[model samples]
Target: MKPEPVILPCGDSALSVELGAVIDETLNGRVLALDALVTAESPPGVIETIPTYRSLFVVYDPVVADYATLAAWFLDRANRALTPPKPGRNWQFPVCYGAEHGIDLPFIASRTGLSEAEVVRRHAAGLYRVYMMGFLPGFTYLGGLDAAISVPRRDDPRLTSPTGTISIGGIQTGIQCLASPTGWHLIGRTPARTYDPNRDPVFFLEPGDTVRFIAVSPDEFTALERRAAAGERVAEAGNP
Candidate 1:
């Protein structure tokens, strides 16, 4: 049975519509469907909407739309758009897994009882689903990790991980676009600029997108970075 959504106040002008308590794809689908519905409907005074793992935060102008009225409208639209999400675009990112780039690969392999090469192969082979984008702009929360390679987060978080770092923690994997502190084990690095403020869209990946990590050599990494810096689209899209 589908769970009843919980509408909660979020700050003065935003309300969060939680579709489910768990972080599952089905729940995320419902959340995203309602997000699409809200965007298409474009209710008066609505400013923007942010979709997370299983919730949608609707921001509106309080002067034009009251909280009680907005909350009721959100719930009404959510109930009407309960259809499953359609498959999103499939994107392939080139990743270079080496000592300099993936500093935590060896440790992750040792902890997971797998060889470093095997770990890389398994991680790259995954057809990961983008559950949501958070923590940072273009930082994707990816699902569909191979359980055999799954490992716990580091006891001590790294002070700063480089941009394009691909890592895994618990049962989830993710791609970080900015230098930030992290506990996830870094297994590879991509040259694709997932977040570029100067770009047309400003974000390369989105929630509901599918990702495939393609292993590349150090030489290829340098070439790709140059192209990406020159504003070339590093990631290619296909049918998911």
Candidate 2:
């Protein structure tokens, strides 16, 4: 059996529930399960809940709730055998690898001792889990990368990477929501806008969603990008 989680006070209005010291699916699942339970129950004074790799940061209104009471409540829930949450939505994103889109393809292949084509093949083949949305708006930190192709992050971080950049760092891969500085190796580019403020749903993907990459040619990428810019939903949605 798993050991009970440690609950600690965060300032005067928040609580930090430390689930584990390492990053694992089971630990993350428990965090999500607790988040779901809290959401469903609508506990008083809960302002927001942020789930990370191994902990849940719960913000609350101090005026309406006390730290000790909330900590105890969260501690009891975290230690219980939580019912696993329902599977999240699955999304298929079109990715154009190599050439200008993935300038680091050759480098990644060299580092991993695999051909460029093989690198792309392995990357697109895995079904990645959206462990969390963080760092930037709609930026997805994904899990389930193929260990064979896993490589370290770039020694020199880029000043800015284009939106839709697909990259890998350490044992994980991720999707760039917008143009931003990144240290991960650039592998591909996707037309799917994970975050678009003008769109109905500002964030297309959420934590707990699954993602699959569909390889596409550069020509196809241009066409899909045009469609996406016109506010079209380019990524295909799969049933959970």
Candidate 3:
């Protein structure tokens, strides 16, 4: 358990708390704990807390709360939460491995020297890390993929990958929120919408939240799609 958040020269914020090399539940619990501390005992003019996998950005009003003051306060509490807690919630998401959902499945298969089914099997076999979130809302950088499954991203990225596109690249797996350009290989897709603006919190998954993949049949995929199109909130695709 590493203590003392590293203060850096962040462009927008006064002080930053860095908990390096966070994996599994450690990242999520630490993030939540630190956020609680800052928000509760915050100095005057403290504006917001932007938390990541192993860091939190404390943006404050330079007038009321200077950089030096808030930073020390944060360091004090952070050092104390290093004892550790229970692991994060494990979420298993269903995937329709190949064909349309996995447009570049064959590409990954060919490159990795395995059949498409084998590629899917290996991909869904292991647990992954929630390294960081960026490029788009709810988009997470997950680690822990087997080396054999690793493949380079596309040189010419697609213009739009649509929403719920589950793809992999290098050592990370990403899910595109809304429509956006991507270089990751499309291994599968989820009919379930991961983020919704109208919903109270919008995005469902956060940094430090862990997820697993569950394979599904084409018939199940169609059933899930119909439910989603009907305006039902598609979490885990079909109703639990």
Candidate 4:
């Protein structure tokens, strides 16, 4: 049985419920379950909830609900055995892993002592889990990478990394939905817009969802980019 999560004060507007110290599926599942439950309940004065690797941050209005009251409520509900949340939408993104997109493929291959093709194959073979979306809008922190291709983050951070760069850092792998500086090793890129301000739903993937990478050619990537820019869904949804 899992121990009761510790509820701690987070500044003046938020409270953090720590599920565990390590990154594990069961711990993350509990965090998601609590999030889903509260979302469904729609408690008053709740601003928003942010779920991370092993904790959930509950933001609320202090005027409406005091810290003690809110913390007690969270503790009561968090202690109950919550059925794991139903699996969310599954997504498959077509990635171009050639020289142009996979900027650090050769470096990663050299460090791992694996051929470039083998590295790409191992990366594409991962069935990643969306642990949480943060660092940027629609940027998902994913888990479930194959151990063979795991690589450490770069010692020096890049000044700028292109949007849609698929990269790995330590034991975690994620899709960079926005252009930002990062230390992860970029292995590929996708045309799909994980965060589109014009779209009805700005975020393409949510926590509890699953994602897979489908290798595509450079020519195919160009076509997909055009289609995506024209407001089409570049990433296809897999059956739940």
Candidate 5:
């Protein structure tokens, strides 16, 4: 299908809504607005919102709710959230592309027939919008990648890349929160750790937020690594 809003039963305790194929900042705003409206008129069981590239997965408490009742409420809010999503802030996250940080940078440059510098410049040229967070705890699927640098996934997925590995997958750019196997082309690594199971909220960076990438040097990544190890925090590009 082209892309449309879809709601599905999620194990009786939760409900999932696929918001459709949204790729632009404006569309992202509309999705978030519709999400907010639904939350505002939240039915008894509604719990949280999960926004993605083209969908929003609405999670709710199943103990007190059922799909039929909540789906009706959702459909109602979807009708209203059509106005637009209110603008949110843009975030910048620093990345040290290539080498140990980005294992696939060289391979990608070889395939794309461009200098590594040009690749990095294109990757960092524009701010990306947080399309959604899923697949992992704090991982974010964002838009705004320049198609010129877009490439296919790696044939072999790594056992895990360190948390904060910045990578390109198809037309999207993503930040890794925890080490996990992935097929995306690795371009850089970030100093930011957006997920912490021990932390009160556990996750930061919700959908509809904007993200920017600032390329950093290898030495800086080493310093940031040290700071991270010492329990001292590195001043990453984005705001909490």
Candidate 6:
């Protein structure tokens, strides 16, 4: 039998429904399922729902809904069998690997005991799931990394990582939406603007989306970056 979720209050206005302690897809599925249920029901005073790897953080108006009442409400539904939400969009992003674009490619290859080409090949071949978005705007945390290339985070994190950085840390891989400090081992970069405030949809990727990386040359990366900067949607949407 599945374990019951632990409902813990976050101050007086928000609560966290922890489904599991690990980063398993089943647990994440439940989180998303609960998010869908709560959103569909539109519970009174519920302000927002944020689904993470294995928990759902629900923010509500404390005046309209007390913590005890809301906790009981989430506990009942979280323990019940839930229908998983439909899969989100599939996206194919063009990436430029090795050399300056992916400065840590050699280090990652050495650590993983794989050739540089093999590392890039394995990374590009695997289909990744967008588990959640956090840390920064449109910074997507992805699941489903190729185990052969998986490695621990960098011992020394860089002060700044460029936007469009594709990296792997621990058992996961992710796409960096903006230039920021990161501990993940950089393997490549994609020109697609996952987050663009000026664009119609500010965020391109969302939780539950599947992503594929396509290797591109430096010239192609430059061309794509230009197009992306000009407000063009550079990433191609794939069929579900």
Cα lDDT, all candidates: 0.88, 0.89, 0.72, 0.88, 0.75, 0.91
When 4 and 6 are scored with lDDT, the better candidate is 6
Candidate 6 positional error at 131, Å: 0.7
- Candidate number of the best lDDT: 6
- Order the candidates by TM-score, highest first — what do you get? 6, 4, 1, 2, 5, 3
Best by TM-score: 6
Decide which is better by lDDT, 1 or 3. 1
Q: How high is each candidate's TM-score?
A: 0.96, 0.95, 0.80, 0.96, 0.86, 0.97
User: RMSD to native for every prediction?
Assistant: 1.3, 1.4, 3.5, 1.2, 3.0, 1.1
By lDDT, the better pick of 1 and 6 is 6
Please give the TM-score that candidate 5 achieves against the real structure.
Answer: 0.86
Clashing pairs in 1: none
Q: What value of lDDT does candidate 3 attain over all alpha carbons?
A: 0.72
Worst 10 residues of 4 by lDDT: 197-206
Ten consecutive residues with minimal summed lDDT in candidate 3? 231-240
Please give the distance, in angstroms, between residue 89's alpha carbon in candidate 3 and its true position after superposition: 2.3
How close to the true structure is residue 161 of candidate 1, measured as C-alpha lDDT?
A: 94
Tens digit of per-residue lDDT, candidate 5, span 7-73: 7787776776655654766556667777777677677877777765555677778788878988877
lDDT of 2: 0.89
lDDT of 2 by residue, 18-115 (tens): 98887677788888999998999878899999888888999999999888888888988988897657668999999999889998899999999999
